[model samples]
Target: MMVCIRRLFLLLGMIATPAIASPTISVLTDSLEHPWGLAFLPEGDVLVTERPGRLQRIELATGRQTIIPGTPTVSASGQGGLLDIALHPNFADNRWVYLTWAGHCETGTATHLGRGRLVGNALEDFETLFVATPCVDSGRHFGSRIVFDTNGYLFMTTGDRGERDRAQDLTDHNGAVLRLNDNGSIPSDNPFVDDPRGADAIYSYGHRNPQGVAIYPDTGALWIHEHGPRGGDEINLPVPGGNFGWPKVTYGREYWGPQIGEESIPGMVDPIYQWTPSIAPSGMAFYRGDLFVGALVQTHLAHLELNGETVTQETQLLSELNRRIRAIAQGPDNLLYLLTDQRNGELLRLSP
Candidate 1:
């Protein structure tokens, strides 16, 4: 009975109570050159990608780094470089580490997907699985993020490369998601498989520049968040071959102040959630730990509470630290890890 009184007093701030413990934050490693993506190995080692076209393996306990060799030379332009990385779901059996990056092709700079085994600090047996077709010289909008589903298929986001109109082009690879087997083969059952007029690898279309992608915890839905023009950042569940209405239907105006496409085109899918001023969301992971729930909200503006498909609550945890969030992940120890995008980047760890 007295405990209830104490709780009420604490909530009301009517009594001076003991301070509660909060989640701890620490910088695991700095000196990363524009670190863009992060992944964890089964053995607790960390894999990180720097936009300057380097991949490094980090020792978590000591925060030491060893540069993995044999990466491709990337077209390090405005918004392009080595982007995202992911481990093969069965990493225990397959030592393959897949990577997405921007490279100069015969036509121009394009987003590329490739993989190789992590053999002795070198990427051995590397092969390019796919190259975005009709490459343009512009280094922006490499809508690139990678996620693997439960059925062992890869889903990757593709940007419109500053060519907004191409998003509606069924024959173009820009502004779409690609589904493939680990070996980079398109699945036969993909939405456009039967349509020779579509880009063979396309799973969906009409995306702007999605940098964050994740599978929902409660539902296995493949969700994505993309950058909007001026005021309409969006979170969407892209359907196979579905049009998301970029350039044709948007809630945002052009940079110079003019309405974009129609607000509600009959055939386009609407976003589930949107940010007006834009959070500039990057990498993401679903929470799997028991800490920081009863006391504080999840860390640093990355965690979300949901009721089925709807986000019931949203939060930003470490904005006080003043870092541009680039990636978020639940590590093997059930803690949160993050990367910041900057010239001298950092890898951070959060513990409850």
Candidate 2:
């Protein structure tokens, strides 16, 4: 009888496999041209950013797209384009919005964080809030992901601009997590405020190219996942004033042949999770919902979860969705939404 029950279970597994909609995909908006970032407003409208520096609004119910005017021009070169979009904490009352993009600098080009008032249907009072110091001409490695902490401080990640040594430079803002007040002022409580070696805005350093950043709703801890050189993607929990050893102490190599650095570093913080042979992780989010009971607790995200780390007995989704996922966020309906990266990208919705 036990053998017969086991055989019945096996048959049920096979029958239920193909029809299960894991990482369930649904099109929120179709015919969108290179949508990079998405932020839902209080009234259920979503503001999406196009890579070529255009902002648009999509009504959730109607699926209508309207282009927002008065957006700033961006450099739009190799990996340098309109990036993350975030709404101000008090957006409903304040009508403010923030954006990050690669902008033109006097020397060359650099990533800039700008804020403005989102009037009834247009963006007004555009202001360049923060410009990365010592702008370089290289258009690559513009890590412009943005997130707001519990204290209403803005955190932005900047890449090393294809220069590995810049990750270790204290004076340089590249390859560092920068903390700023809402209006782009350095907080007096920031770590390294008086350190002559490092900039005051530098909260933590030694990152390759962090794209995904989200605050843990339960613990208020800041979590990030960055792309590795050739392999060795990392999920890190950043502490205040901590030094995350990048090229100096990486699980990855130089993409040519040499090792990155020694494994034993005294003061450097090691990643809690590391993936070898690379998942090309771009965006991350912590799942907190009741849709998948007995699963989905502090689940770190990636496009694929072949060798993922999780605290619950969750199943791997998106096994066949062969695409580089760029962003993930929770929607108003308690469902998960994701954006795929490609020439013809897609906005996907997921459920249990």
Candidate 3:
């Protein structure tokens, strides 16, 4: 029965809708102090983080806010700030919450991962679990997003720190998807563990600045959306030992001028989807709900449909939202929720 329902959705997604509905945007909370990340608790409370290093809990019904203490200090520079927050897979029992942020080192800023227990409105026994080593001096590229796999491993995305060449460097953890045990230890089965040139912590390599990652509930596949140089934004299925050709091979052009890398390189992986003109895509989620039949069918992709030129009935929700869409999640009631990025960003709910 489940397989039949999934197949039906796939068929409907290829068709077009007659009308596009405008989302009803509401200001859930303002003056949030540069909100960066959001996650929902099982009891219906929302946890949000401020880029300047503060965590707050928002009551879903009352709209009341409480600051969560014990958060670590963040660099909070250009593009470098308190980044992503994720609840542990078993948050109900463990109360564990994970955080990814830009931490300052003697040389510069690097993305770091930390975990703590959320007790009431405070964080208890907070500890730094993993820190990106050989930190660079620039704050340009801190690709710090967190997602947990069904196998009980925590995966994180890291940028190349604006050093284009590092994307192909197996010796560094930058521009790669890192797989680690929940407690911050390297997994023994990681793909590059024994490779002399590769870092054991790496799961995949050759990425630019990946900002969004989510696991497809139905397929358990890891999906990622990354920023391209001038125009080529990409959606890819991240697999261990796969090389998602970035600076070495891209469908995008250099920011300064004409095309840069070749799109056809030996052994380079191709993106499942690419967007020209750059949506600057971030924080993706696979919607598995009854409200949007079309979206549910396209479970593995970021957007509901392909490019505008290909589908006239499609609505460009990302462009209409204006601000960079930071995070996406499905609520308890099976409604789609989105987090916008900006000083006065909003939390939007999408339903039928």
Task: TM-score for candidate 2, please give it.
Answer: 0.86
Q: Rate the local accuracy (lDDT) of all candidates.
A: 0.79, 0.74, 0.74
In candidate 2, what are the lDDT values of residues 1-352, reduced to their tens digit? 0011122222112236656433335676656666678888888888888888888888877668889987888988888888988988888899888999998888878879998899987999989889877789798888878999888999999888888788888888888889999999999988888888889888898888888788877667777877777676777777778888878878887779678786548999888766676666666666542111100112223322212334333333443445556777778876667776667766666543
Every model's TM-score: 0.90, 0.86, 0.86
Q: Which candidate is the best by TM-score?
A: 1
Cα lDDT, model 1, residue 31? 87
Off by over 4 Å in 3: 1-23, 289-302, 306-314, 318-321
Clashing pairs in 1: 143-159, 300-317, 300-318, 301-316, 301-317
Ranking by TM-score: 1, 2, 3
Q: Which candidate is the best by lDDT?
A: 1
- Which tens-of-lDDT digit does each residue in 1-352 have in candidate 1? 0012122222222344356434456687878998988889888899999999999999999899999998888888798999999999987788899999999998888889999998767899889998888888688899799999888899999899998998889888888888888889989998889998798799989888888888876667788888788767778897888889897877778889888877777878998877665566677666641111100111244446666677777655565666777887778887667787888788877653
Q: Which portions of model 1 show Cα errors greater than 4 Å?
A: 1-20, 288-300
